[model samples]
Target: MTDIYRKLYTSSMMPSINLPKHYNYIGAFLSLSCNLSCSYCINHLVGLDQRRKHLSGAEWVEGLNRIQTEGPLPISLQGGEPSIHKGFIEILNGLRKDLNVDLLTNLQFDPHKFMDLVDPERFKRDLPYPSIRVSYHPETMDLAETVNKVKILHDNGYSIGLFTVAHPDALEYIPAAEQACEENGILFKTKEFLGEHNGKLHGTYHYEGSVFSKEVKTVNCKTSELLISPEGHIYRCHHDLYNKITPVGHILDPKFQIDDIFRECTYFGKCNPCDVKRKNNRFQNFGHCSVEIQDIE
Candidate 1:
């Protein structure tokens, strides 16, 4: 395995809970408020009844800087639309250099403004994937407009790419999108659609009944990813984060540490697809699971 992959599978280097030193991934949801309301949005799958809140840029910087890791480990800034955060630019400029930063966005923000405020090198890293991932939603996004924005960023030396979920309904449009990206010298990829569409589950999951099920069951579950909400609350999994369940810790807390152990969960059947899905690891190797669940009864 490469050094980067090794770090991902290694134990935590610092003394703070059992969080592996080379953590596989760190996801920071700057804000869950998105401009587009696609019909298949996973965030609204179970219905987010509460108003989402977000932390200021300074708070996010302070909290995220505390994280210690080595090598290719990156803190991914994502959200319903991360750029919608009030301090999006500040946060981008504020993260420590040692902490590699990646972004998942919709390419709806102003590229000129981003280029003016942020240094492109800050997002550059020696990794297999582009540092910035732009999602293309054919339903609500204009393909020409989105491609123009990506070209703007790409021309400015930012490491970026375009990804569209392979929704069954949207499959036909993907090839044309890919060809367009290729013509523009931009990387375009497709992600497997997760969750139910027309009463059928769409993705491969490790657990049998962890997604789209009406019944709930108890099970012991533990996560490998560090999922931080916009307000800095940490969750055991994506299911807990979007559903607003109690968090395991607050990133701002000086004493906060990751508890790398399994806890009992009463919503096994109602789990989010992101958490239970059997997918590729950072190395693109198949059969890797984000969380491990057992003890179901």
Candidate 2:
């Protein structure tokens, strides 16, 4: 039997997902299962349950191709470790040509095999940062091995870089990674750690007091990015996506659509800092927040 798939579009046709009209970004979680289980992994704290079924590669391609967005903004392939997905490269090359593609990976794959299968320009762009971002974990990863892999990919003309978390313990190693990357002409940067460590919270969040606490309150929330879970479920914020909380709808259901309106959420205090934080606006400039929350009830 030939497989048939559905498409998700506007709200009038089907179920509504509160989203901004102009989706500046889209994140497709190929799989929330990662090889290395870091203790500080926000996925675990955010209520990311691995039991959810992951969509097949074909389902992902079909679902992603149906996104009707209006911008040069790319669809980011992310997750516990996006590269670990069975069809990582296939999904990367499978996206619509009009839609730019980006990746957030740990660079644990074989680079030679990746380069031989995929073209360079698929991830290339005239941007301030590299299209492919490799995350560096000092405790769970070896610095030398990670750096070597990054250098190999960079030398091959692939637009790639390194991003390390600024954990309290890892902060001391950030400068070393940065200097190493700079010496090798690699773009190495740090991302603020979101969860609590050593009894203190890190990261600059937009909504004050919106994490870890058991407090749940109703609030109106909207997002600028298109967030998809490993099961192809679309959500309004990282809070919903990671927390296994309420999802607006599923992608490629044809019945699923973007509402482009603010909706009521009961998990306000438990919001993911990534969604509530006021951070860079793609240009690496500060003060750009991912979600706008209001009507605290």
Candidate 1 residue lDDT tens string, 1-297: 122323443222212333575357789999887888888988887553257667788778767877876567788999888888898888888877877999999978789988999999998888888899999999999888998899999999999999999999899889889988999999999999997788888999898878878889988987888999987889999999988897998776655788788899999999889888888777668788888898977
Q: Model 2 segments beyond 4 Å from truth? A: 1-21, 46-49
lDDT of 2 by residue, 1-297 (tens): 013433334324433233344566689988888888777888887544558788878778867877765546778899989988888877888877877788998878889898999888888765577899998998888887888888998999988999999899888888888888898888888888888887887888887777766778888887788899998888888877876678887786775677777888888888888888777776667888888789875
In each prediction, how many residue pairs overlap at the backbone (N, C-alpha, C within less than 3 A)? 4, 2
| lDDT (Cα, 0-100) at 265 in candidate 2 | 81
Q: What are the root-mean-square deviations of the candidates from the true structure over C-alphas?
A: 7.0, 3.7
Model 1 RMSD in angstroms: 7.0
Give Cα-based local distance difference scores for all models: 0.83, 0.79
Best by TM-score: 1
lDDT of 1 at 175: 88
TM-score of each: 0.91, 0.91
